[model samples]
Target: MPRQHITTHIAILGCVCLGLLAYLFHLDQPVSVYAGTTSTAQDFDSPGSVSVVVNKQRPLGDPGYVPAVLIETGGISLRQEAAEAFAQMARDAEASGVAITAVSGFRTAESQARLHDAYTGRYGTEVAESISALPGQSEHQTGLAVDIGASGGECSLKACFEGTAPGAWAAANAQRYGFIIRYPAGAEHITGYAYEPWHLRYVGPDAAGKIHGAGITLEEYAGLYEPPSAPPSSAPGKNAVEPVP
Candidate 1:
């Protein structure tokens, strides 16, 4: 196998092994209950739904579908609720001296296709698939996923952004505003993408809080999938812990 592929495989295994150890260590504790208990299959299956789980394994319920309503905020369009929530999150972040910028949102199927094609051309199929979602399998098509950046443009869209003011702030607080770092670090294998600190997906406050609080992926939260092990939650205030890097 190629060196990079081998490295990635090792990283994935490391995360799972760490997570299993954490789960075992915390076996005496009760796993947190999912707050979004009412979420149904349609919630994760419909593109227009707030809790939709579009990914490589689950394509959009309807291809080429457009959201019923989209609203522009920070020069990017998103579903109405998501736009409003993001706007509030930005406002609060700015009040705390963290500047948040929206780099992309609400892509059409044609746009996603072009973006995927571009990545595939530059990186080849396997790498491209890990970095970019195919057209109908993208969360952006639902207008709930947004790529964020810092106003100063430092480390924008880069992994290093996770350490930047905006990125750190969002990672710690986005869930309070109904969003999550969709493809979080250490969960690339489960998420089917690399760690993208700039990618925030809104799943409503209830779902976001539960997922964030538990330190698990949407697949695990929605009962679609689970990694062999779970790392404890590292978020400061959350009681649920998982073993993670």
Candidate 2:
């Protein structure tokens, strides 16, 4: 082979090897890649995304939007990915002596409207808005949020549930199963809801791990929270509706 041709081939091979190395690096640090470049706001903001941010300030783009794929688990429906993760989490929780039951999941717009109206009628609009989501603003309508409880229904949906065994276990271990207690204590200002220990939202393992480790609300993790000076004009005071039995 000619000397010049040999040198050119060597240079080309070096470039190819460098490219392969970079690709392998990306694969090894998938979350970094996801968080840095390839992961756009759209990934976590769209209605069907596992990491979608549904909150008072960020309602579903379509008021009547529903998840395309939902599956039943424990007599409630969740997006397929969330349902599968919840099933595994439930099994593991039971194995660990904490019985977690799904109390509510996947509310439709109509159902949310009905619940919100009932709460408004009973508590009056101002107070109801503090505890229940207005129609088109509830995360439950996204099919990614699940209201959970102990198997025997101890302290379900109430603030005291945070002290229950299932709640404690889930608070500690739910991120492993890609769930987060969506409205965590003292984050109501950012999340637009009070502490809801039983409300678990599936954001997939990577975001769940990051959110859990950072101890931040999804609104913060997703950069959706606004400071008081520049608050969102349409932000609802509360963004979750209590499950009505």
Candidate 3:
């Protein structure tokens, strides 16, 4: 072979090697880290990674007040029949002596923004950003979520009900009521928000059972649904942060 031809072939081989190295480097990027698991670490590592998907409904407007009495003292009024079923499940839990209650129900966009601002006020903008979702980003805006507990007390804003008996009971039996924990501990990697045991999302009995039984985040189960909607607002009523049993 001619020397010139041999030199040309060697140069081409060097270029190919450099190209392969660059590709591997790109694969090692932080975003690529998500490729490893159904629950990805990078998904919730930062605020920008969190994104809201618009489903059956558009994002909500400012959240109006629905007297706390209506949600906590009175009863959790639900627009969807599935929500009513959830209330019924709470009643059944009450029979078991669990004493379930709704702490937070439907929340409006403005209400959610206020809550977020409050958290940020105390916890700084960046940290607060991770712990709380923006108004439109919150499931509470969707009115499908209800924070449950042992009794009606202050639970909204931020409460780690996972440790209490009622919290534990709800965690165990939420599926029966068509409710899911939504965000479980250790899954901060998958869910952008922190672990919220009291946050129960109503997706119907079958979905709730499957999600709880499978031990996965709503984001993952979201794929099972034909389409996914936004999260619900604070309790469908007025504030005062009541605990959901």
Tell me, by lDDT, which candidate is best: 1
Model 3 lDDT per residue over 101-150, tens place = 77667666687788889989999988787676676666665556776655
Which runs of model 1 end up more than 4 angstroms from their true locations? 1-42, 228-245
For model 1, the run of ten residues with the poorest summed lDDT: 32-41
Candidate 1 residues 122-226, lDDT tens each? 989998899888888989999999999999999987899999999999999999999989998899878898999999999988788878888888877777775
Candidates by lDDT, descending order: 1, 2, 3
Top model by TM-score, which number?
2
Report residue 146 deviation for candidate 2 (angstroms).
0.2
Candidate with more favorable, higher lDDT: 2 or 3: 2
Once superposed on the true structure, which residue ranges of model 2 sit more than 4 Å away at CA?
1-42, 227-245
lDDT of each: 0.88, 0.85, 0.61
How well does each candidate superpose onto the true structure, as a TM-score? 0.76, 0.79, 0.59
Worst 10 residues of 3 by lDDT: 45-54
lDDT of 1 at 35: 44
* Model 1 TM-score, all chains together: 0.76
